[model samples]
Target: MTDPLALRHEHAFDIRINFDKRWSTGPVYGGASIGYTSIGEGSTVEGPMLTGTLVDYSGADWPVVRADGVVELNAHYMIRAEDGALIYIRNLGYVHRPLRTKGQGPDEEPDVPAYFRCTPYFKAPEDGPHAWLNRTVIVGVGQRQPKVTAEDPPDHSLFRYYAIR
Candidate 1:
């Protein structure tokens, strides 16, 4: 069996931000952003595109109001293939929170925190050549929300090609 990791294309999509919250905020502090992009299939390719941001907010102190420490998420989705033709899929997003440590002794080192704790934002139909350009929202501590804009259309020139030996 071929390895899925190997079969996958490298950076088939180009994610650029018009303005990133991280740029203004200090490096260590957490923030959110919105992004836009077009999804395309290279040379008759067909499959759903899974896109989203991976966030790390463990370093921040917990919120006093909410029981949760901090919320990290990827508002993303999938596109379904239709009638062997390319279609423009609407962009959809969702929010997720990372799992936190429970009652543990201070002496013990907190277990290595998981990067993405929430469930995946899955777009159904899982196959297609669709274009979905929507504003993705990522929220972090202190109710910080950032917006990301897509500067350039994605280039799929170097997509992976496979053939029977």
Candidate 2:
């Protein structure tokens, strides 16, 4: 069996942020190629974002920081071949949680919800120009730690971001 966390190169779409909803979606043009290594099935990656920082670059600044606000992410990807093609492909297979900047990780493990229609973006094929294809979103958390030994640790914070398909 293949390791779920194995690294692979793939094409991804541009990422767009939905300011009002505080969510991001893939681009509509063509997919952007990206290099990713699997972190493992059902594993959480945590990080921190500057308090009250805006996530979207193009939109007005909206504060994401709060006494409670922390970025949390959980998702899984799938590898498959496009129809009638021999090449193996990996896409965001499921979105388990909303993107938010918060203080800590979720208390329980997340579950993969239903699949949604991903935005189609153009991606340059290996041998030709870019073409449109629906891209998936990958979600993971970020973590911050204090400089301390394993026995005595400081605070831990979690952040989240989505990679384009």
Candidate 3:
């Protein structure tokens, strides 16, 4: 007999959303508000089978921190494929994680309840090479780090996606 709980995933892509600055609207109903957007050489995407860069002047992410500590982020961006086909992706995720302590590794993930997870929806040309993106069920894991100044690497939110089969 096969185990029904067993699941599989295929590597899709990864990205680093470079942070430039941040501004927040103080506590309001349900939670606080955050608005994020970037332009000009936005970011890059690379992986086993995907290659693209976010379109210059077309990216935004709004992440809100609730009074209870969970963060809700909605990111919208356009990617220019190596073949020049344009793809739009909206990735929404949530987290209730604590900031990294003194010696945690950059790529480590906390236990459940502090987990950062996301679901990505894509819009690609129906007849294009990336049309697979449109129908596949993709899930992603995300992590946000801290950094400041142009000299230091900008703070970035990292994400990797996989298609469930």
Off by over 4 Å in 2: 4-58, 68-133, 138-165
Return the TM-score for each candidate structure.
Answer: 0.25, 0.18, 0.81
Give the alpha carbon lDDT tens digit for every residue of 1-165 in model 3.
877888978998898777655667777876676655453356788887678888876877777877757788787889888889999999898887655554667786634446799998999999968999988989999877667666877667788989887
Model 3 residue pairs with clashes:
none
Which candidate number has the best TM-score?
A: 3
Best by lDDT: 3
Quote the positional error of residue 76 for candidate 3 in Å: 0.7
Error of 2 at 136 (Å): 2.5
lDDT of 1 by residue, 6-93 (tens): 6332222222112111211222324433232222232232223433221211111111112243333323322223343322222222
Candidate order by decreasing lDDT:
3, 2, 1
Model 2 root-mean-square deviation: 16.8
Give each model's clash number: 7, 27, 0
Clashes counted in candidate 1 amount to 7
The lDDT of model 2 is 0.28
Of the two candidates 1 and 2, the one with more favorable TM-score, higher being better, is: 1
Give me the displacement of residue 151 in model 3, in angstroms.
Answer: 4.4
Tens-digit lDDT string for candidate 2 (28-130): 2333222212222222222231112112221221212212222122222222122221222222222223433345357634333322222211222344221
